[model samples]
Target: MWIEGAKQAGVEAHPWDNLAEEPLPTSVEIEGTTVPVKWLPKPELGESGGDLRNVVFVYESAEPHLRLRWQWQARGDFGPVEHRITIENLGGQEVWLLMVDSLRLDWKVTPTQNLRNVYVEKGADSPSAEGTHLETVSDGYNWKGKSSTYAHPVKDEKREIIPAEIVCDSNGNGWYAGVEFSGRTRISLERNGTSLKSVLGLDPEPGPFKTRLGPGETFETPTVFLGAFRGGPDGAGNQLRPWVRAVLGNPVTWKDPQYPLMVNNSWGSGMQVDEPLALKMIGESKELGLEMFHVDAGWFRGVGDWYSEPKKFPHGLAFIADAAHREGLRFGIWTDWTQAALDTESGALNVRDPKVSDWLVTDLKPDWKPEDFKGQTIDIGVPEAHDWAAKEVKRIVEDYHLDMLEHDGYLVAQGCVQTDHPHGPPNRSTMRVIHDWASDFVLASNSTDVSYHAVRAYYDIYEKTRREHPGLLFEICNDGSRMVDFGSAAHGDYFSITDTYDPLSNRRAFYDTSHLLPAAMLESYVEKWPVPKPENFLYMLRSGMMGWITIMTDTTAWTPEQHEAARKAFELYKAQLRPFIRDAQMFHISARPDGVHWDGLEYWDATRGKGVVYAFRGSIPDEAGHHFILAGLQANKHYRLHFEDGSQPDHEVSGSELLGQGLSVRLWNPLSSELVFLDEVAARK
Candidate 1:
């Protein structure tokens, strides 16, 4: 009967099938002996968030005397299941544990004459590297791998890309799984003839290679997420999106009334921004209805120097912050807190410096000489150094009265190897400490008891900073989305998708990132490229409307007529796209850009009975326009449709006809675009 039940729940056939009656195998090595653990017969179930169910299962092995309390939570009938594992030593003896698997599940398969198709989709850690790739697996093979490890800043340039999430679609059904950890994680999928098995766990090596847990000592694994969908790969991928967002616990939402349309000074002036140019940009930004004004880079003394440049801001950064605040706009500045400049006044020591050898991790290979360190990176794993960073952050926040801090150069310490710090020895494990610090700094938490001391110290800094400045926001920019992950999303409010201004690349990024993140959390900036012609410039603006819109250009170079037109485009975006971006479900009509052709996306709010579709044309002269079947609407409802450009007359049509027939969009010229708005009107009698 238990075997039959397991089969119904997607369990595959295996030699240990009879063990279906037992809980998933969880073991611990104690005193040189491996001990098998058994789960308590009944799970403790309770209610959470009114509709969610929480199940707690305690697994233990009396011989080794350890307990692992597993907490499985289901948000609703359709939501994914999230679980976390916590292991505690119950006996009065020390236990040398080697591994901990947070989750293990078997997927059932039906026998067929031909090999079944299993499709997998994976994502990378960086924004420039963010996109889904499809892979097919057949019988008699196993796909095993660990997540990415950036041994050097440019390692990704040479390494084969790995997926952040491993989703599989087989037999008309889909299954999705991803680790919520920002650190190293392990994932595996195996198919043998008729059975499939999937597993997720932390990468335990180097330091935790042998965790000696004394009596009462506890260790917790990062949360793992798993879900199954009846739809295909797209459905499976979409199902994980909301689940990931929920797990991150980010407070900022699309519905936030105060969300800003930010204007950045990077594209126009470069990194050499001065107070006069900043003040001029602020004045123009206000006239253009920009809610936030940010000075990107160049304001500080150098990379690690958080203080304002005395020459650029003779009166100090507080003056600029106050001026923006008085103009009713939020102020922000950019800085890279992760690394110090080689020529800065601090004379900070980089991780590869021989003088800081005692303060670095041990992962620095013996063969690699100190001269190989190419950039400045301070090892924040040291208590004194970590504290100093925290104080510096607080000083800037209070001294400038800043509302947002855009952090760049996060990968500066990707290769640090000093292991003499308090956390643990210098090894690959030390990288996890740095990653956790970056995560904690962006996401402020009230929890006092984090599992790791290094992580807790960073969290404490953010927590206190938040208390002092309640409305502060953190934007994570790691040399163009290198650090984008669930952990960063949890801590930071928004992410700059890419720093490049190429329209085609930016368009592809928009389509790809919108799949994994909400439109509000993804900010796309319009570059000052292609000479900013009216037609192409408007196309760039519309392309970025799917996410938060950022205009990066020089107002001083614009003519009076150009300024008027730019202001009108910004107004139209604020009126027509902002609500849809905030509340509607995004549908990627074209996930990739086809050279010199049409690529687009749609945003629809079914509950509100309204939506918008954005269509674009490439640079090919012969390519005129494209037709896309609009999605996410009530088929039977009558709707009013019109183009934002006013080239087409407003007309009435039923949603069914529109969905069945399709919406045809024609641009006025090559490399142009159009915006179509749909609203449900009175039903035809």
Candidate 2:
């Protein structure tokens, strides 16, 4: 497939055989006959113009067995090209799709021997050492590990793997690719002489079941994005970032106050939040200049039960929402809408009750009793189930006067084979239901439809609710950062990076996540547990300022000085960071912290001609200070620098000097941080 935007970016294609291997680019079996597919150029183009264009190519078997539509889309003049494959069963017989690669391409760029591949290592669940680690691809170092085992029995026994985004960069230019799926994805780059071949697609671990497509049935593959950059890794990141934002749609596109400064009552009160405590937090949050107060978990009676806990909120949930509204703050509540606690009596409403059983997608173990189930998964594919969920959401928002709903749960719904379900039987893929619902919802609301299966349900729920309750904000938190992908961002207003309180982890997450997500849609929170000292607390607070800031600590427990400091910190973030975070581009300056080095990132909005650099020194010993060139600034304009930590005197430097000669700073103390603000100085008369 040819991408016009990519060609405009000086990229050229090579005539290399893309299907000369043993495992075909796409394999399908119909009537016990395997067919070889060949790509044929289509007459018409897909979407075009506005920094993005799509060119589709069709692949069909020599015999009339199957057809695959490859839609290759390009973003911006030099941005990435994302490709998604759609397989359609052309014959009347049922077809079994064995494999379909999301990306398969060969290209020849400006030749250079200094090229190196880049990947990231996502750490385990442990708090102390958990972080996203970047590494260069080298020989004998397979990022996905030697064995491709899928879903091993032992959770911690899996080999170390990297994230989906991969980059092959020379000193001057680079090539980047990323699989958009949130689940297991494989990306590989191979060099043969001066040419490069890249392969990326779903890495479906060893599984028994195969996708079955009947006559005229189609299956769409997860998208794989590929692009080339003129600069190094940063340039590659820049190329991918906008494409992702365009695909996901910006937070501002959905609601006002695009990047909200939220105070969440999660870590502060845990699941024991009461009306009094919630009201108190709302007041404190308002005083701290927080725009939203989110009551996370425990607000409802149970997982599936949307009503407020009578003992905890005797006056009902509306009381808390009313209090927040009176304080001039938006009220938000959290729920795991996908699952119901098996232990609660309400679980019967989702599992045992005949009227609702068809509404559930929970797959029981062989011969297991319903009472033995730990959690009941709701089958949104069922029309009744979908309507019930929408009603509950509307009920909560209307009754509580809520402005936001934080949807927290798993991503993919387990396949339901029950024939009684509305969307069931042979095609158990929940993706179909999601697509149908989303299409209908978007049409009903008169909104443009962005076809992303993973977030379709989320988009439907959010759009349907917001249609009635205008200005409703939706947050997607899939048990931490597991589902932090374009699909989630497509519907969610903002995403919580993780639920952990570890300051270091949150800081490192901010650095890595910023590479793919815009700062406005990425949120970081200061943890309440194991509270840090005043300076460290400030560091934690500052770390979160790189994106949307959320404070999860109990204000009542803080001393008068701490409370005052928090208020000051919130004010500082609002004054220094909020103005730019919504539109500012992020540039990483330091490496991910290993506890021995200073870590930092920069947020610069070239239009505003101002930015902020946030740097932190970990506990371990290394350097007393660090210096790095600031990015995204006007070279000829003079800039005024202000220090938040008072470690440096106010100074003036030209943007050329800041970008070329670099800006220097010293923290002096370990476990400390500093924020450097840079604004273009007014031209002298």
Candidate 3:
């Protein structure tokens, strides 16, 4: 079917005989044999919801006692369409299934169309040197990008991505697709002469990925979304961000005006935080107009114990929660809920426990000891462990009086050495495990299955948790930004976009991730960074303030001037920036921030006829000015510019001038910044 537009980026029409060999898109392996399916033209129709419609095509293989179904969904009135494959074992015998891809497409583009592939990487652990990538898809081009909860690239190799890609011509009029599963997933694009081929689904490598489908059981591939768009990468993102919010995002969260809150977290002192410090931060948070007081790592009794640290919080977490509430601030705490440690408390997940021993992905060394905030990962895919974790999550939220819960570290298993677990064990001889980045990455025959099961269980737990506590926000920090993808976007309230919290890192991470996600869902932690001047301090704060802001420092220690500056910044964010952040068209008006050049982001609300430009002057000497070409404006209209920092004189300019000549921002100081707010002259009807 055509994409209802010009024939630029989509599945172009081709002869039916061209796809004769692979007419049916679903395939599977049974008992170590690749079995091709024969699909019949019997179509079944159904309505899913007010906005979702589904079409199912039943296909069958020669193998008996098996049922295969391919389902395609049309969601919303706009944006991408979704598709997935499912196979069910109908008889009493168990069937082994393998290698099912969610979606695949072949597009016949014009020869030498000058296509370019645009994609972004996960800020896994920290933002890599090249967070956003655009490369040519010349003839004979072959490319692949993988994604999981986290990534640890080799010394020189392709890194993990945010699990999406856009391939368009110079005009950015092309198709984009992404996987919706947070487990080990992969996307591939290949160009050979006039043909463009791609695939999206669970990574079927790490080879011949296998899963067990028992009697009356079914296995489904991860769902994938595909769409065509114009206006290059930014154009594609503008459509994607809203579609994600309207479809995948939590409806309850969006109903509240204050969905994306401003928070203060106590990680500035590291593991040294206690009752006095938390209370102090709470008061500071209330004074500074921050909404939530989030207690990071140090507040937990131990990694897996999840209770309050008694000596540190003598009155318990509930007492601290009460203190924050009394000061009119919400409370949240961080927990590596699935990691097991050596804590010997009664209810602790001690690795030495007989029952707990079987739950871990791999047996721990006899003398193995967990790091300050790190521990051995448990396989939440295992049913017993899944139940335990789901209960533990509910308990933590209820007992701790949490308005939000942040799950950090390794929360699920992608690899395991246990033979009896649900996903079974990796092949011993071919299995390879890398112990780096304080986490274990397994690569083997069964690794994909391990992640598949674990991801499903993790989703179920969170889905239940959301139902139980309707407004409780979930922060998915699988080692901080490692899990930034559509899957996590649907499951969690926001993502901690990166571990590095400096101004450059925060802006760079946000710039890369916000391409395909709602700005409110891409969170950045405002950690303690070198701030020689109060202007620089606001610059650091506003770096993360573009999206979700979490102050991760000792606010009580700020100088009086800095405190007032921060207070004013917070007030400005709430009144002026928050609305655009939640609902606006964002454009990366400058190239990626290099720390040595001027960088800026434009958030324009065409409907509201107002927006703001977040401009930052980098560390370059004598180069303190830059012109940011604004976007999404009517060229014939006139606009009024208000410089909050008076970097330049407030003036009126025609939209053609602003969009063409650009918004000029000049900061005298090297590390200073400015917020240039703009509105159409015709704003008032």
Candidate 4:
């Protein structure tokens, strides 16, 4: 299990060799097993004609979960030649994989060994205390540190080195995703947990030179490392296969110690407190171990302005925050800082002080005054504008002792006018003006509370805000699952796969997408929006328990069944919180493109020890044994399977039977899934 020059099975050693060309196709001997190694023509070299084939060398390790890698070019004629190394394995055990932490161009290799001079938190007075790439000689292999986006300028500069990166047993359990670009070349990685993975070729390349393989029996751990030059998809297919397999094979684990999922109330204007309804919901949420209760929109009468309507609650807005605190649940309020109703009846339109006149809530037309204003947008960039906002919002937060802010609606402000009064130039695009306004608002308001925001539209705007606030959990809702793609997910905490679907039917799609992209995606929604349904809430709460869950119901409209489901869902949610946040690994079991019976697997707390398995069925209006495979299981373990009672019947199966046997099964029940738990087993084999 050890390497010839290293003490551990996971050590990597690359001693720079001055030799021009060792041999045509050499071999790297590791643990007494030699892997074939050779170099091909690097496409980056612009070869008029030659082998055109890049280099590839793979070594079989003695350990069940290891592979050795090495690559270099022998064409001495191409001075300053840069060779790309890529590996692919389609097997049960994963290889300890890592990329070269440097950029090689024009024969000059620049290591990501020094990042202190490259990264800086944009506005920090002191040298930003952000994570930077620092080179280390561990196990004799030089390693570079990975930098979080917050600490860098992020200009997408060429030839510039990116920060270091690492995927450990804790960070990436089942699969991982990352992007690497150095002014000229870019590499992206996406690992599928199992089956039909590939590795690609980069140099001397017009297209990817792929290697497709799997375990001795069936393909498991489909990994891919998509490589590209100048950052495009020309070489994607080749790199994608191996990259996915490598990630799937890597160890899966995380540390989610506390389970604290809970039910929430958020609806249109969404969460206007009825005092009585608020009190009941808060108490129920607490009784069910729900740690948080979010009071979504409608509490404030003004959109751009922040103030609670005493008439709506009668007891005062502070009463609800206080009630939530008394019940030991964290309290959150929604804020759409960008738009304001200009209607004269709205509380937001009366601020006309001459000094702050530029911040006036004027409509596009003169007849559109606050009292009678319709569809008027506020200009937040004028210093006085945000000044007005902060005073009102701070009062609410301070008085309520709020724990989180559900920030929403910045995208709606992009095209609104900022008035011709005086803040720089007039007629500026709403996009530019609003960006400045939003950034200022977040910076001016700092109470050390957790805040969540919505980036419903506009990808670029969401990315900008994300860069500014890494701790902030941002949700991207493109209205439905069709918009749920890789491009949108790279920048947010979770993607609400589908909106406003009946939970029982829609949960399958949510689980399927979560299974497809676990590392970078999660399921979410404002449960029961537009209408309240127990089945919808139940399904959403169940799915959310495994990942990210949000609920939006008319507290006043809950039926007896809805109430019970809410209570139980809150409990299950709390139980799943720790795992959901930690090692939430998902492996796909089945995918029904026709919306028939969808199947997938999700395991929370896979990294930090004990875990729970979640399986789901698509819409089924018949009786049939719905069957699917389970993943993230130990070969020697015993598992007991449970369903959602009326949702499905209970069942049991051995982990060895579901995953180790290389066999698939079916159930007579329709549109349902089985939740499996292992009672006893040895450490992972």
The candidate scoring highest on lDDT is 3
**Predicted candidate 3 versus true structure: per-residue lDDT over 11-87, tens digit per residue:** 33322111212245354555667665454443442223332355566755545466677766756556777777787
- TM match of model 2 to true structure: 0.81
On TM-score, the stronger of 1 and 4 is 1
lDDT of 1 by residue, 1-685 (tens): 3223223334333222211122444666666787766654333332233323565666666766777676766643343566777777888987755556666766555445232233222212223443444555567657654532221223334321222444444443655565554344457776666666767665543334444566887766656655555445445545555555555644443234655355645446776788888788889888877888888877876555567788999988899988888889888877666454343365444444455444433334433322111234454545676776677778778888888877765432322333344332333423343333222121111001111333334445666766677678777666555545554565667777665656665676566666566667777777666645678767766666677777777876777876777788778777778777666777766646653788888887777888888888887887676777776677888889888887588888787877887777877687788888888896656
Candidate 2, 517-600: lDDT as tens digits: 666777776766444667776776776777777777777787787778778877877776777676667787777766567777
Model 4 earns a TM-score of: 0.50
Q: Is candidate 1 or candidate 3 better by TM-score?
A: 3
TM-score of each prediction: 0.80, 0.81, 0.95, 0.50
Whole-model lDDT values for every prediction: 0.59, 0.61, 0.83, 0.37
TM-score of 1: 0.80
Instruction: List the candidates ranked by TM-score, beginning with the highest.
Output: 3, 2, 1, 4
**Residue pairs clashing, model 2:** none
- Candidate 3 has a TM-score of 0.95
How many collisions per candidate?
Answer: 11, 0, 2, 53
Model 1 regions more than 4 Å off: 1-52, 60-66, 75-78, 89-97, 111-130, 140-173, 203-217, 230-247, 252-255, 341-375, 379-384, 411-416, 422-464
Name the lDDT value of residue 592 in candidate 4.
Answer: 27
